[model samples]
Target chain A: MLAHYGYKDGSGDYFIIIDTDKCDGCGKCVEACAYGVMELIEDEFDIEDGSMAAVTEEHRKKIKYSCGPCKPISGERKLPCVLACSPKAISHSW
Target chain B: MITAGVDVGAKYVKVVLLEDGRKVLKRANGIVGFDILKSATEVFEKALLEAGLNHDRISRVTATGMGRKAIHKKHPLNAGEIVPEVIADAKGAYHLLPAVKTIIDVGAEEGRGVKVGEGGKVKDFVINERCAAGAGTFIETMARALEVGVEDMGPLALKATKAIPMNAQCCVFAESEVVTLIHSKVTKEDISKAIHDAMAGRIASMVLRIGVEKEVVLIGGVARNPGFLPPLKKELNTEITIPEHPQYVGAFGASLLAFETEGK
Candidate 1:
């Protein structure tokens, strides 16, 4: 858990991966982090309730810092942002 | 023993008159002209009167800042003909805050940093004259967003809640972002803190890159912004020294230069 908050790799080295199919394109990812690493992009994701929702201009996909990538998110220890995400649009690399 | 330094910055002209390292008087105004020399001379004369001195009593006059070259033409001092504005600021800060190793100066359209050695010499420095984010405009835009005067920002920001991240890299986009955040009901403190955080992060990165030393000092007009100091200090993990008159350091540096030259 401690490692989760602190970046593992050298500063400016870690990268964040997003699953577009699973991503609902909400901005919780960007809000959870203080570094302004992620941004909301426009994309679509199918929900579990057998409904297809499209992310319009009202919605956005989250991208990382412009200068570099975000930390690597994995299964056992998913991205902190993904865990804090309320819209359930994100998951770690399994 | 009486000397004067004039700094005609992009947004304001500063005049600092010193007597043997003791500051006699200082004045600043937001004035510009096609003939930067005339504008500087006029401001200098006004400052002289304020200090109970005359042009003839000023043994040497040194010029520093973007308008320094133009100001130099008005004064007939060969040794004081050309000097970088940042260098003059470093010299002034070295006199007032002798232990200061890192100096940050935020002007209207630019920001400057100086890393000085123990012997009052510049070790290294960085400048950001090209970006509005590094200057006072960042807070000015925030002031517009909050519907408050720029002078009120310091106290107003202290009342804000959690900081809402302001992600825009440029000033225009950042303003747009603040408007959106405001519309979303983000508290003013959060927005203000976010703005300060973003700029502080930028400054921290630069300061770290430059290898900052202990006893850092923040100067320039924006240094008056109350909320900027706490966040900047926290982010940099350093104590910052700011004078009662932070905005006059450049002119003070310029004045100190004049005094040094006159003594020689």
Candidate 2:
């Protein structure tokens, strides 16, 4: 399942899409996130039947605001969360 | 074989019975109070009695909803599998309307927007977490402020003549705003419309984040509200379909799954 966190308003769609199928529940993304945006959760949707990385409920509500500093609009930099995930399951829709 | 789906929702418990895995047999629901199991058993019993069957005859049971995990295994409501609400909702809507690709479920506590793929697969989904403004409770709370019954709010809102802006995005602040409107002599009808408008706006925004698709279906208890449809239709700019007994769609979907997965 593609779980979209965050919302869309007058500006545009600001969401963090987490593909649970590709995510392996590794804690790498959890530690790499400076804002504590990601966490390992037991994903019931995954066919593999194991935990996976998901955006915390707190960050999901205000994702654009919580991830404001690291947004690509500011400057080009390696996003620690995305970079740490070897499975490449995370992507941002701006 | 007969299968049952138990949807233990926050405000109510819904049960759906299916015969030979595909045909709808009976659907029953009731207000859920302090005892979750008791409420579930009563509703389940009502459905069985209506079908002229006994509890032991059910071959399998699948459960879903906010309170699904809370059900004990020793109880009669014990389900072989506990599926999440989104998957159950998507499956249920798609089964009822195979063409439906987008499903919006607005219950008492939360609202969800699900994007479905072929074969009732869940492609993408969004949930309004920890917020009352996007759910049916928003209307229920506003009804209290206007001294109207929950059922009356919808009809009252249709009588609104002017568009009133309610700026509060949170439920707590919205209540105070409703009180202020009342003190200012604003009619209850207009205030009710504003409440529905605000709620539809929030639900629409969440859905847009994932994108809306054609053949949209609206399920859950709030779909029964007469006032919520107009504003929601205007916001998403698309016609929405509501399945028969929309509140039981989730449970119905689970029953379908129980039948399909019988031998697995």
Candidate 3:
């Protein structure tokens, strides 16, 4: 399941897309995050006791603000999270 | 068919079981301590026990609230179908009063204003997760500062002879201000009113960002505060409607969705 966590309001789309198929529950993104936005959640089926990476509940409602600091003002918007993920499961929808 | 909705809120967990999507079987809630799933299951089991039913009797169980995401496979509550608390709150409030087009839900940790369209669908919402001053925790902290029960904060405010202005909106600063008020011999009642007024201002501003519509309803645990209601009503400049069980609205909405999502 490709879970998109974020809301679209009068502001443009701000989403942190997580591809569960590609994500192997690696905690790299969780470690790389400075804002504690990402968390490791256990999978529903308990397949091999694998977990999945998801945005924390507190940050979900306000993705733009939560993920804003990492997205720089003028520099190359090379986000630490997308760079940290080996499986390339995480992507931001600006 | 029986369906259940479990709401794992920030400060509390709630469970509501519904029969055939219309009739209610039980409502249970308790303080949500550490291990969010454990407390939720305890409350769920309590509701099950009260209803005289087994876990297997519930055909579908949908989970909602701040801690809804915390429900993983290890959860013994058989929680399924993760739904956002905003949606559940909207659905639940709309069910109770179909005319309610706007819902203001201020839980212990967060506050939100949900605009509802036809059939209780969420049209738009503004969530105040960035600030604790806009939530029930603000009063909870102030109540502790005043050395009064949280339940007494509201009623105590009602006795105030004059409205005392609270300078600090942040919970941290507000606590210090309460300490200062104590030193200055400020009555607890006036200070309580100041706390509630500041809290209401923050919440009402959030609702205003979405613009208030007619038939507004207030839900969540804070709705039970008799002192907080008047300030909120005055801030919104409108009459606020509250359900008999305001805190149960989220669970009620989730159960209604459980019934709706039974086959799908």
Considering just chain B, what TM-score does every model have?
Answer: 0.92, 0.97, 0.97
Task: Judge candidate 3 at residue A25 and give its lDDT.
Answer: 90
For candidate 1, what is the lDDT? Answer: 0.67
Selected candidate, larger lDDT, 1 vs 2: 2
What RMSD does each model have against the real structure?
9.5, 13.0, 15.1
Top-scoring candidate (DockQ)? 1
In candidate 2, which residue pairs get closer than 3 Å at backbone N, Cα or C atoms, i.e. clash? none
Better of 2 and 3 by lDDT: 3
Q: Which candidate leads the pack in TM-score?
A: 2
Report the lDDT tens digits of candidate 1 across residue range B87-186: 8878878888889888888777777778888766887776765667767887887789778788877777777778666667568878889889889988
Model 2 residue runs over 4 Å out of place are A1-94
Tell me the tens digit of each residue's lDDT in model 2 across A38-90.
98988667465678788887667556545755653323746788888899999
How accurate locally is residue B85 in candidate 1, as Cα lDDT from 0 to 100? 67
Q: State the local distance difference test value for candidate 2.
A: 0.86
- Report lDDT per candidate: 0.67, 0.86, 0.86
